[model samples]
Target chain A: MIAALRARNPIKPGKLRLGIGDDCAILRPNAGDELAITTDFSLENVHFRRDWHSPEAIGHRCLARGLSDLAAVGAKPMAAFLSLALPKELTARHRGKPAWVERFFDGLLALAAKMNVPLAGGDTAESPAHKGKAGLVAADIVLVGGVKRGRALLRSGAKPGDLLYVTGPGLGGAGAELLALERNPSRFTALKVAAPGHPHLYPEPRIAAGLRLRKRGLATAAIDLSDGLSTDLHHLCGESGLAAEIDATVVPIHPMAQLAEAAGWARSALQLALHGGEDYELLFTARPQTKIPRELDGVAIHAIGRMSKMRNGKPAVTLLEEGKAVSELRARGWEHFRGSSSD
Target chain B: MIAALRARNPIKPGKLRLGIGDDCAILRPNAGDELAITTDFSLENVHFRRDWHSPEAIGHRCLARGLSDLAAVGAKPMAAFLSLALPKELTARHRGKPAWVERFFDGLLALAAKMNVPLAGGDTAESPAHKGKAGLVAADIVLVGGVKRGRALLRSGAKPGDLLYVTGPGLGGAGAELLALERNPSRFTALKVAAPGHPHLYPEPRIAAGLRLRKRGLATAAIDLSDGLSTDLHHLCGESGLAAEIDATVVPIHPMAQLAEAAGWARSALQLALHGGEDYELLFTARPQTKIPRELDGVAIHAIGRMSKMRNGKPAVTLLEEGKAVSELRARGWEHFRGSSSD
Candidate 1:
């Protein structure tokens, strides 16, 4: 199996002195660069449902989760390591091919190639089952990225008056698509190619935008919107020891989210945009005087809020509603401990 | 939970620029050094049984697996990123404390401190359970280490006539202890502290010996004895495109293996030494004329084999028995796909 994976993903010899087949992969980083490392888990049911998601989507999302972290830190990806555990049935060869596993790699390696990252090395093992119960598939992806020394963006670097920005045209497409998937799993079974509409299955990581933000020194603080915007905004504010006020009227809502609201699949598009997780977009803060671009590398950038000082007896985040009403924006995001159902 | 883990394992801040509570951790590698990366999985039932292994031991073994890989490449430990998925019951508070998870970290952080590796960053999620079946605990540990550029030990660097050596007093102690564990698990429930005798539960990684070998330029090729002597030796020879001959009588058998043999726990100490896996010792090769020391630091080194040219249609590895009987040595290590039982 390791040989098959290596054969399919032939790494060019440059940064990687040694690839798979050894106990460890050796990486030679560029001079004067700091390495950014992150790991993420994509477990069965919790992260994806086998019946609702294709093998390719699961693999793509697994790698995307790690790459998004690197983007959050404003680092260029160098290599990715995946440790995968699968049940017996998934490894069995049918018609002389391990179709499911191969398809999973197809999704993963395709993204890796597109992002110019190599699948350096990792471990593979059989998932364990208890008694007559079936085993779940779990994948953990580790990404190693590089940035100029002392130039990586962090969640704690924002100031009280920094303006807030987010990448992409809008948000909550992933959550809306997930709602559609739950209503009809078969609607996405034939969706083999990764396109813009399938954000829930193929959310793209904002690597280019993050790089530009860091290289040009346009952002003060940044974080990937993996857990809803409200939750992640809270994290950024708490880390920076500040507060935030978001203009609800200016929040960019995805067209799909609007469609979901019109179809009665969601209570409101604004609510989904605020609390829908897995968008893989970059939410950042910049100095109020900085002339930030309207778009970066073809991805639209929207300014929707500003950081603020934390006041006694006040919420960390305040929502400025369209009618000038105010409300505390609690983090009703997709927390794993809150429930077992998928978000 | 992230804050608790960070507070418990405070990094002294040298190689690591940032620890937990970020999208990614930043690492500053020393000048003229390359990074070595490795990942390993510890799955419930497959790698450890909850009834037989303590939470601390499980965590120790999980980190030890990745550290041993770093040791194989003669890399100094830098940081460890762990992605853990736990069952609901394991995460729930017991008597106002999350004892199991805390003990797991206690075991892991204790070794990380001893080895000078920081718990830099990681991800945690709830392990998914199917239907009414209980969920399993799975951990994937990623270790990043630094080595001098162009000086890493590799499995493909061995040459014909190179002498084979292994670290520590003996082999098969882990395998032998596993046998005892299978027969009477309750006897080891109170064995909490890490010591030399418990090879299976608290097997030490030979990082010092590997570093010494690389610093002295004594080793030509290297690999960790993770999959047993016969299996790992086969890997070394296969990668080097060479064959090997072992002297059976000179093979170092652990005292625990001898005890297991006396207690009828294993067929023979030699058999256990030959094919039993998970020793976490370094198996390396040195030039025949190199003045390799008898011991590195406190770990003993023994030379019991020599690399040889591969003959057409001949076995990759040959075992010379006690009376000079030569026989083919096949890999009988613990393969995950072979069966559902433990080693």
Candidate 2:
């Protein structure tokens, strides 16, 4: 299997002193720089599924999952290593859909090509069990990206009273997922309430927004809104060692979210806006009243909340319902929300 | 989970610009020009037994496996990303072995601290099954390191007439496992191959030797002895697009192997040397007469083979039996060794 893999793809980069087919890949970075490296995993069923997700989706998703971490830290991806596990059922599935895995690679390569990311080294193994019930096919994607000397973003930069803002419209992503999985849906996909545009499958990660935010010297602290508003806001607040007050009424809701509500589907656009996961949007805290633009690369900035002090004595999020303050908004589903709770 | 994880880690780096919350980790490369990245996985039943592998071991083994990959690649380890799948068999086995897990972190951290590597960012998820037999826990470790660029080794650099060599002793690792698992092996632990060596418990990746080789410019091509000599040689040879020949007598045999043989065991040292996996020794190639060192850091480099063009239009490996060239090796066990071939 290693030999066959070796024959299939011989790494051909001048900078790649060594690549696939070895225990690890060897490379040279710029003349004087520290390498930015990170690893992430995509397990069957958890990150993906053989029954539902195609290998192509699996590959693309896994690759993106890893690269996104690099992006979150504002690093330019350079190299990657992958480790994959195969189950018995996958053999026939993989064989029958030769393109399944290949398409996944193609998806990954497309992004890699766009990003100039190179494949480094990886290992593959079959599950100890033949049945799918007992084993998991897994992959760990490692990325080596570069940051200019003296400038990598970290999580501890926010201070008291920093303005909490997100780079793109929020709340639409979770709403979009509802629309996609819905048994019936019409107005949600295009209506003003949903704007189910970029949320369902591929919400863009804010590589540029982060760069722009940094370049403008505005964002004091930043994090990606992988989790929804309520939770992610709590995170930036917690990291900053502060608290926050968010006006839940003004949250940018998805167009479809309103329609879904009419169907007795318990969804508040505000709730979706606050707690959905995998939105991949950029949520950052900047100096209050910093001269900000309407958009960066055409994505608007929405200020839903302002970071505050911990004077209330408890870390909390308050929602505005019919002009009244409510402690919580429970519109996002358990699965759609992100928290350190279950993970 | 993402929110809680973000809370725990806080993407806060004093020196880094883009830290825990961004898409990718963006950090300036230090005053060095090279970056090396590696990824590895620890699967239940394959790398660890569910019954024996505590969560701490699961955690420690995950990082160790990845760091070892960096070591094999000859990179100075830097940072890592860990993706963990926690099976529900949460043990008070030390309260989910949190301290053990922390010790696992300490093991990697202590080494990383010495090696200047750090625990960067990671994600955790509960395994699908809620019970021990229900599933296995897996962790993928991604390691980032630095190299001198262009000076990194390759498995495809060996030319015809180049010599084949392996770093460290082989098979004694598998031999150690036998003793470690045996009930009355207190006698074997005193032996050099067994004492202070828990091969199955801890597979040492030869980081120092790899770094030394990179610094000294010794090896032409390199691969770690992951799937035994027989399979790994095929990898080295196959990548260089050549064939190999080895002297069965020249191979080093572990001390425990000899003892096992003395005890009326049918297993030959040669078989273990050729087929045992996870020796983690470096199988490197160099030009013939290139001062094949007798020992590297106390481990001998056995001259096992030479690269060659196909003789008589056949890709084969010959062993000197009765001082006559007998073709005894084909690509017979590479696939089987890795379980990549259908039984």
Candidate 3:
């Protein structure tokens, strides 16, 4: 994770100086206001499992998870610190020693290195006495970002009439997640697995997307779709004291993910796409008619929802079906109380 | 950990401003340079175990482990996040009701609140998929501390003539660690099992002392002894390109610790004191005669060594029995690869 993270680190400017891979990652607070900070942990059982993903893939996704949260608030990641726990069984399971850790780093650190993000201080210790019986390992990744004073994006920033748009294909992560869960996933078409896993394993955090949204004065309110579209949208609506209108067909699910062949599984896919967590793509609200580009780096731009008044004025999510109002839907996103690892 | 951490947080004015508890901790740059940021994780097993610590105590110490590192470089903690993986067993064993988490918060959040530190964001999950296996818990604390345009503490800053002084008692943690490992630890000295539960349960991080050293412009080079005296001192010396001399008799040990009674154990205690890791006290070098208080807070302030030319230095540590040198010395602090978790 460290080496991969180090590999893509950008050449920091003189003022944005840092030393990665040290006792503590060191940097100068050259800014006038205080710095923005956030942390997120991805565990093996709760977040990801080795049986379903590679170490590098896990490393990359976890860092992206942290950074996406930072970007949700319009902060630019400056450094990442990774604290990892390894079961004693890792060495026995993976024959070669450093190679496993190295490959894991290859996926994990590569994302940070690209952004010149320093991999700072962290501790590594033996796994809990559980010995991966839960069939997973765990890691926590933290991103320290900087933003202009009081200019962070807030979920409450969304207002009535704001258009909800996403930067990339919205449902890719959900598709990939389902594929990951399947017994014979590779039997599925390559395209279905590619996009979601592309972002799922090694999410390209919309660091630049956030900056551009803020810079172009487009985003009024923003959030990363980490906890699936349903929960996040509800979260934004809850904070803004508003309701929402999501057009189901416009959510931009992966074109090749033949989830619909499983009959209502397509709806589950939509639900997962809407409610499946770990899509680091940006789900932000802008002016009702912001002229979003036709595409960004070939990823499709999506306009699947709109902020609205609460019915009789209550905050809720209303899905559109055949030009008629749907029941006030409970967002089927990952809920801490739900107790399910998958949405 | 959050409560205790909050309790010790120092308030600062301006854009370094943001509340601690949030989806993501917010920071606006101060205005001058970029922000210096870092995150660190402390995990159970890798960091601590429930068998040895009270929830409140564990909370405070786990978080403090990272804070001390920040203090070494004069960084103010901005926000902290916690990712707890509680096994059904340990959680229930510790009155696993959610209120226990609150108790954990009582000390943790208090510490953060004390410092005006906030709990920005974090996640909680079931422990490594088992009921009886040891649980996994992690705290990822991100520090957004200010440093002058070109100033921050570095281990490499010591000059040739710098004197090395450590705050608080040195070998006390080692003494405590011994108690924690014994099958019949209760049979140990009363001083050992007193309020603090020996060095095992709570190793007070020397944040204040390190910060004072930084603010007063005392130490030229500094590092917290998370690893042990031998390795940490060696790290400082190696970084500074200097040899060090630590007088054996001058090193402090906990008063009630009876580890010294056994034959090879006295030397072992000395070795533990020198290199026993996780003391989290500061090891720093200053001018040969730099004036510092006799004690920091209630902790002792002792001068045990000095930086010297490396030409003829045999072992970095020595025993002065009746002021005569003894040759049985070897570096025997905690080795991550070879050492057991005991020390």
Candidate 4:
């Protein structure tokens, strides 16, 4: 299996001194760089449904989760290690090939190639079955990235008077697409390849924007919108020990989300835009004096809010709605154990 | 839960620039050192049985599997990233504490501290259940270590005349203890703490000995005995393009295996010594003329075999029996999807 994976994704000689078939993969980072490591899990049902998701989508999203985290910190992805557990039937040779697993890697390695990261090392095992029932597939991805020492962006650097910005034109497309997937799964069966507009299936990690923000020293703090905007903004505020107020009128609603609302597939576009998760867009804060660009690396950027001092009675996040209405924005995002929702 | 984990394992101010609660953990490797990364999976029933092993034991063994890999390459332990999925019931608060998960971390963090590695970062989620049956627990550990540039002990560096050696006095203690646990599960319930005698419950990784070998330039090739001697030796030889020959009489059988054989619990101690796995011992090769020490870092070492030139018709590995009869040694170690066994 390791040989098969290696053959499919040939290792390009550079930072990785040793690839697979060893005790450990050896990486030689550039001289003054610190390594950033993150791990994320993609479990069946918790993160995706086998019935609703194609194997390609499942594999793409698994690697995307880790890459997004790396991008949030403005790190260049160096290597990725995937640990996968599949049911026995999924691994059984069909026509002398394990097609499902191969397609899964096809999706994963595609993203790795685009992002210039190597699939360095991994471990594979059969997911355990019980009482004759098939086991759920689970994959854990560990991403190793490199950033110049002391320059990597962090969530706790936001200060009062910092302007809040997000990459891309909008949010909530992933959630809207997921709703569509749950309602009519067959509509997306043809969506096998990864491209733009399939937000839920292949949400692009904002690596370029993050790198621009860090390289130009424009952002004071940064985080990826994995959980919904409300929850993740709350995380940024909590980490920075500050409060935030975002104008609802300025918050860009994804076109798909707007279409979902018009089609009666979702309740409200604004609600979905604020609370939907898996956007994979970068949410960052910049000094008010910094001349933030309208678009970064071809992705539209919008200033939607500002950081504020934490008052004794004020909520962590406040939403300024239209007609001068204001309300506390609770973090209704995908939090594990709190609800049956995927993050 | 992340906060609780951070509280318990407070980050020491050192190489880790950022720990948990961030997008990614940041590690600043010492100048000129290369990074070694490895990942391992611990799935329910496949790696550990809930009834046979305690949560602490499961956790310890999980980290040990990854640490042993780092040990094989003679890398100094730096940090560990763990991604865990647990059944909801196991994560539910009981008596104001999530006891099972906490105990699992207790076991994991204790080993990390002992080996001077940190609980760097991880992801946690509720394992998905199906048909109302509790979902299996799965934990994947990724260990990142550092070794002097160009000095990592790899499996491909051995020559035909190099001598093969193994750490510790014996092999198969873990496999023997596993047999005992399967026959009488309750007899091992009292084994709560990690000690030398309980090889299966808390197998110690040969990190020290590996470091000694690398720093002193002793070993030409190395691998950990996670899979049994026969299988791991096959891997080493395949990588180095060499064959091996060993004396079956000199193969060190663990005292526990001998006891199990005497008690009729095992068919033969020799079989367990040769093919049983999870010993976490280092199997390495040194130059034939080198004055190799009998003990490395206080652990006894045994010279078991020598690498030989590969012959077209000869088996990859050969065993010389008690009466000087020669026979082929097949790799009967645990392989995923090949059999219903654990590695």
Candidate 5:
């Protein structure tokens, strides 16, 4: 399997000194630059169920999670290291051919090629699942990215009057997740409007926009909208020691939001927009005087909120209906230990 | 637990722009330098059985595996990212306080501090083991190190006349295993001579030794002794397109080797030295006139073999006793899929 992965993803020239067949992958980050490193784990039954999610979806989702983290730091990915733990069923050579593993790499590498990042080095191991029990297939990806020295955007730089913005569509992950709960994954591949679109199956990281925001000196603070709007906004605020007031009506809901509500998985588009996780969009803050554009690379950038002073030292997110604070966005996001029941 | 670890090991200045409390840990490798990255998976029941190993021991072993990889490439440690998949039993807050989890971090952080490597960014998730099943506590560690440009050692560089050497005592891991199988956990701590010594409990990486070899332009090729002498030698030979002849009598046998044989675990010192795994020592080949030192930092450097031309296009390693080939070393080392049953 390791040989097959290396064969599928050949190293690009001048970037990697040594590739897969070595004790370690040797890489040269651009001179005088900093490397942004992030690691994420996509675990079975917690992140996805194999019977419901296709191998392609699992692979794509794992890389997307790590890339989104790099995007939050406003760095350009150079290479990735994946450590995968395979379940026993996948290794049963006597039973049948394991095509799922190949397909999983296909989906993962396809995304990597599109993003121009090489899958350099990794480790593969067997999960400790006894007979008659379902084992967890976990993929832990470490993404190495490069950014200008001392210029990587941080989560703790937002000021009181800074404007907040997010890139890409909203609630796509939540919409697909609703259809997944219905337990008919084939619908995701067969039906177009009734299910989630390509946005959910293959969410692209806002790398270009993030780099632009960093290089142009536009974003004061940045974070990926991985843990839903309310929870992530609270995180940014908590780090910056401030609070935010989001205009509820201005939030853009996913096009499949109506379908999710009609299927009784979501109460409303507004609710989904507020608390839906895995959006993989960039939520950033910019100076109030910065002349921000409406979109970058044809993706809409909505102005949803503004940073404010701390509100009574409680939770840091405030949802404003019209000009008054209607409620406090006290909702939580994905918790790996507690299981992402809300997502 | 994450906060505790961050407090325990703070990032050193100038090397890092940001640490722990961010989307990603930001680091700056010196200009004109290359980065060596390696990842390893330490899984429950595959790498170590929980009933037989303490949390601290497991933690130390996992990080040691990754550091050994870096040491093989002669790269100085920079930072590490760890993704831990904890079982439900450990995460259950009501289960009499999760001391094992804390102890695990304690063990891991202690090694990181001693090695001067910062614990940067990581993700923690719940393992998918249900009640009554043994949960797998797997840790995937990615270590990033810096090396001079175009100077990282390669396994394929060994020539016919190069001499091979290994650092540290022999069969430490195998000796420890023999004691562990005897089911007396306290013996390893109390009766040091009766069991494997500090070499087993805390296998140190020969980072400084590797750096010295690289700086002095001594080593031609290098590999870590993770998979025993026989298996790892095969790897070096296969990469270099050469064969090897190892003198079994000259191999440095650990003092506790007798304890392993007396306990009916190993047949002889020669056998254990040939096939013992988890030594975490550097096995490198140097030019014949390199004037290599016999010892480094109180560790013996044993020259047990030399590279040779391919023998019959097969049998990459020939075990010789008293200057005559006695047998071909063909026994396999630990395999994750096969559950490391032989070890």
Candidate 6:
């Protein structure tokens, strides 16, 4: 297993003094830089099901989870470690070889290579029991990134007047994909227009855009859209000690949102735009005076809301339509213990 | 879950610029040191069973696995992260909360506090299906440590003439504890004398001893006794292109080994010492002529073997009984995917 991983992940020279094959990978951070580390746990039946996701897609999604967190902080990836807990059945040798394990690494390594993130070191173990019973398979990713000292983008730096923007193709629509995929997989496939619109399964983490935002002093506070716009904006608001006033009509709805609406569901495109999660887009608050561009290196930026001072007896997130308060955004998103209701 | 972890793990003021609750943890390493990162995945059924082990033991063992790797390289831990994949059934709100999860962190945080390894950051997620069905629970720990720029030990630096040493209260004996624990939990409980001998369940990573060994330039190559004496020695031999010659008579047998033998197990004490794993002891090679002390701090150092120039087509490990070659040691040990035969 170790040999297979090392072969799939070729040692990247420079910066990394030592790589995989060691007891602990040795890394040297650049002078005047601070290291940023984030971890994400993806599980079978929870994050993805075997029937729904290919081995490669599972691998791609696992690493993307951690990379998205790095993007939220505007940090560039240095290296990553993976810890896999496989059901023993999956690890069973077929024709005297581990074919499935190799394929899984192929998918994971492909994404790592595309993002310039080196797969440094990790551990792999199987489930204890295998009395011919299938169990859960999990992948945990730990990403180490670096940023200039005192310059990391935080979720608590937004002021009351800060403008809130959602980066990448859009937000909220990504969550709608999960809803469609779970309710009816066949419909989800038929509704898909192209690759860029499938935000749930194939999330493109805004790594480069995040670094650019930090380097150019564009975003004051930032967070990844993992738990939908409503909940995520609430998190930022709580951290910044402010509330958010969102213009519901201006929010960009995903192409799949139309499919969800056509199915005669109670939710409209606007509702999906506010409550959907797993977008992996960058949601940030910027100074109102700053001249923000509509696009950055191909990523579309859309103004969705503005940070507002908390008014007595008001929710953290307020929905505004035609400059009048319509309703409050409730804390609803993809929660771990919460059942399929979140999806 | 976040509140429980924070309450248990108090922040230590120092190089940690930013800790948990952020998108990514920010750490600053010392100017002249390099960072060492290791990850260990502890899975339910594989590493521990919900019935056999307490929630606390599961958490402690998770972090211990990663810390042992850091100890093998003689690095001082700076901080650690945990990624947990929990079964949703365990997280159900039953009498106003998750008591088991809190206890799990209680045990994990206690160890981190004792080791001075701060709980930096991590991720938590639950299994999707929790309609009264049990799912897998797993924890993956990522430990970041530090060692002087050029002093971190490698497993490939052993010379032919170097003397092999096993540090900490002998190794092989600890693997016997697991066998006893699995075959008959009651018998294992009755056999336990005190804490010092129960190496398998409550392992004290030789972190300080490893640091001392590296700083004094006493050990050339080192590895943690995680995969038993036979396989780990084979790993070191493969890396250094040298073979090992161990005297079977000098191997320390755990007190529990006798219990396993009394229970009519086929394996003897010496056999358990050679093939049993999860010892978490440090095995290294030092200059034969060096006047090494019998003890460093409180850890016991035992010279069990010697590194020898490899003869083509010979086994990596040779076992000697009473100064005569009894047989060659085959690379047989606990393997993840190799079925129950390995366990």
Leading candidate by lDDT: 1
Backbone clashes in model 2 = 50
Query: Candidates' lDDT values, in order?
Result: 0.88, 0.60, 0.62, 0.88, 0.78, 0.78
What is the Å distance of residue B24 in model 6 from its true position? 1.4
Number of the predicted model whose DockQ against the real structure is largest: 4
Error of 4 at B96 (Å): 6.8
| Chain A TM-score of each candidate structure, as shown | 0.96, 0.79, 0.81, 0.96, 0.91, 0.91
Residue range B179-262, candidate 6, lDDT tens digits: 756666654433211234667666777898898898888999998887788888888888888998999888866667766777
Q: What is the C-alpha local distance difference test score of candidate 6?
A: 0.78
**Worst window of 10 by summed lDDT in candidate 3 chain B:** B185-194
Native A-B contact fraction in model 2: 0.55
Over the full model, what C-alpha lDDT does candidate 2 score relative to the true structure? 0.60
lDDT score, residue B228, model 1? 88
**TM of each candidate vs. truth:** 0.97, 0.83, 0.84, 0.97, 0.93, 0.92
lDDT of 4 by residue, B16-74 (tens): 88899889899999999999999999998888887888877888898999999999999
Residue-wise C-alpha lDDT for candidate 2, range A56-117, written one tens digit per residue: 44566566666655555555666777777766555454436453445556556655655567
Q: Put down candidate 4 lDDT per residue, A1-343, tens digits, no spaces.
A: 7887778767788999988888999999999999999999999888888788888898899999999999999999999999999987776668886477877888898889899999999898888887678888999999999999999999999999999998997998998888899899988876667988888999899888888899999999999999989999998999899999999999999999999999898899988889999999999999999999899889999988999999998888888866353999999985422334222
By TM-score, the better pick of 4 and 5 is 4
Cα error of candidate 4 at position B2, Å: 1.1
For residues A164-280, could you state the per-residue lDDT of candidate 3 as single tens digits? 888775565544545544544443323212133465555667777776676667788888877778877877887788888887777777542335325444455566666666677
| Model 1 DockQ, alpha carbons vs. true complex | 0.57
Residue A305, model 4, lDDT: 91
The TM-score measured for candidate 4 stands at 0.97
- Expressed as tens digits, the lDDT of each residue in A1-343 for candidate 1 is 7888889878797788888899899999999999999999899888888898899888899999999999998999999999998887887779886577888888899899899999998888788777778788999999999999999999999998999999997998889989899899999977765667677899999999999999999999999998989999999998899999899999899998999999999999999999998888999999999999999999999998999899999899999976354999998776532343211
- How far does residue A192 in candidate 4 sit from its true spot (Å)? 1.2
- iRMS of each prediction in angstroms? 3.9, 4.9, 4.8, 2.9, 3.9, 4.3
Task: Count clashing residue pairs per candidate.
Answer: 0, 50, 65, 0, 0, 2
